[model samples]
Target: MPINLPNNQARDDVLAGRPALWLNPNLKQDGIWDTKLPVRPSRVSEAESNWMLIASLLEKCFPELKATGGKIESALIEVSPMREALGYSSSEFGRIFVKADNDLPVAGSIQARGGVYEVFMYAKALAESQGIISSEKEVDRLVSEEANALFSKHTIAVGSTGNLSLSVGIAARALGFQAVVHICSEAKDWKVDRLTRLGVKVVRHNADYSGAIDLARAQAEADINTYFIDNERSQTLFFGYSAAANELASQLSKAHITVDDNHPLFVYLPCGIGGAPGGASYGLKAIFGNAAHTFFVEPVQSPSALVHMMSGSSEQVSVYDAGMNNKTEADAIAVPRMSEFVAEVMKPLLSGVFTVVDDDLFRWLWIAQTQQSIRLEPSATAGFAGPKFIVNSPQGHAYLEQHGLREKIANATHVVWTTGGAFVPEEQFTKFMERGASLVKDS
Candidate 1:
């Protein structure tokens, strides 16, 4: 049955998570993507310092990272071939880049940046107060018996669909914190079992991501010893994610890619509740100013952030309100509701948002693997459709004309931020790939 909703037609359509493109009418006119950053650069720098500590800790504690000399950051692999397969023209889109946070070390997703950072921030603060880690060198203390004992006295908890839980649970358990992950019902069983094997408490909820988050918040409030990693409202998480822009900027500079009035940059990020994309967009805006056009991509079944921003409802409206189930194979980004904090911050920072159907994700996944030797999970593949949509879609053309971006289109650089996939169990990833292959064969 089609959903009969009680909003205006546009709002109803958005809430239903129909595949669509929406330009932010509230985007600042005089300075494109030039808004006051939600968080300060100093705060972002602090998060970077924490990552340095984490790097040191990994060197001393984990043999795997230590063997690689503790190189914690993932590469921004260039995938111009993948872009060509996706129908991006080199003459029009200039070039295509892929920021492969999908291959991030440890937790193997973009969430590793924020999720692990939040856990580290919490653990570091508690340890510093107890004089357990007085210096960066003492970061190794986290893996020590005494520090583990201290961490065991505190509990770290979060709610996630999958990726964020892997990051938080793995890091928290490594540091000996009693980690509790409240997972949405749709989360893969492999993720749950992996966390359980790490000795983290995995609590499964028979509801959507929002419901799981609500329950996790209540539980954290009930226990003083429990420190909740608030995905929706954590500035720490946002700043941790914001740090990526600096690294990306360096990469672009090294490649001789310029972002200016003539050479514009377009970034496509896959979004869920919007923390990671929002933070990254904020940082990119700060770095590239008017030269960067940032857009978020979402699954058609759960375009939570776009629907909220477009309708001006923020957290008050959900996909369910439009009679949508918020179900999709992109489990990591299957959020029903947008984070109010991110929605506010993203209003001025984003260029636009677009939603893609599950079939589109699978098609691109197949194309990427066969044509470009690149493989990504369904959620990560959301950004693969961005360049084509921005250049070819009617709504996209209108947006460019309205924003005076038509002239710069020829010199635009598109970057697709692939969010997560590396840690997916081989069998699970094979299943995703098989589905993608079958879809391609049928087509």
Candidate 2:
């Protein structure tokens, strides 16, 4: 069977690498769990339990975790100033909040949610197999000299454009494991420098993200001591990210926000290969059911998830197949293709996807800093345009009417998940700010 996308301008725009919105025609309001999903909701609680078990070891490894008592979590900030700067009134777009993962403790990005958790999961499994620790007790002895010797024999490896490498490398090294990161040409110099400073082996590839991942997987398969963190098909990574929804639920309760039918919730996440956003959307759907609407935001030139999902193909599809160049300044999310595991899991759960131009990302980055004192990378700022796209576009309005949510718009809750930037060097961040400022002035 041939894959048939919608014969419309939106499809044409996506193929041309222009900004557009593509709603999931197969999005379901019920029976989401009827399909065999890749990661189950029960695994989310398991991941939470795993985090608690390793909390002590994390605190022992990083002094920064002492403030949060070894909890790797971020704040949910209500963004009144930034919302206003974006030209949206509360009545028009409801309440807007920034899930400030950029300020998260470990990797300073959303990758901290999955990348760190997956590394911890691996460390725990390795220890259990060696009889170094038991599930009944805390992992206090993980930093012992004997345990470190055991970890030294193994290597944790992954392929990334940038942020995931930082998250995995930092966590693996902190746990006394040898860490190797295979990064693509698009990866930023600052990320490579950070990994090198952490004593992580950095393998530079002159190819794209998929090529780097291919090389990493092949090398890991050949080495008995190397454990590859497969971004494209890791159930551990998916569940690790899904666990974040529990934290979001608790934060929403504390903030006195409602997400019932009368008060819909809309979450906009910046997507790369789609593991983080796909896991997040799946978790949100499990918690809020029909009340939560989750969308993935991507760069126009690298709409990997959007293009693949829109095609409705069982085989993996790359943005290049749709005539996109797979080029963008949002290097962190410059993925040519999305994870097939994520696509299958999100086919029913995801509400929609939208694309943004690079210029708009910079403009939003400037607004986030000047208006709210929130620092973020270009990729992190992708979600800032989500609310506007949903409220103003024809497809967005049609979606609301189709779902009987037009009247519920004023009572909705919008969350823009900010992905990364806390560890950005002063000089690099200064350059980002300068470019953003120039874009803002010209606009």
lDDT string, candidate 1, 1-443, tens digits: 23333244345446555677788877875754245645554665666666776777766655667755654566767776656556774677768888888888888889988887888778878888899889867776777788889999999999999899999998898788999999998798988989999999999999889999999999999999999998888888898898888889988999898888778888999999899998888778777776778999988888877767876653456776656678899999999888888888878778888888999888877776677666577898899878887888787898778867898887778899988878777888788888888887887
lDDT per residue, candidate 2, 299-364, as tens digits? 998998998999998888888888788889999899989999999888988988999999988888
Q: What's the distance in Å from true for residue 283, model 2?
A: 1.4
Which segments of model 1 are wrong by more than 4 Å?
Answer: 1-17, 29-38, 67-71, 135-138
Q: Alpha-carbon error at 306 in model 2, in Å?
A: 0.5
My TM-score estimates for the predictions, one after another, are 0.92, 0.98
Q: After superposition, how far is residue 207 of candidate 1 from its true place, in Å?
A: 1.1
**Ten-residue region with minimum lDDT total, candidate 1:** 1-10
Candidate 2, residue 434: Cα displacement in angstroms equals: 0.8
Best by lDDT: 2
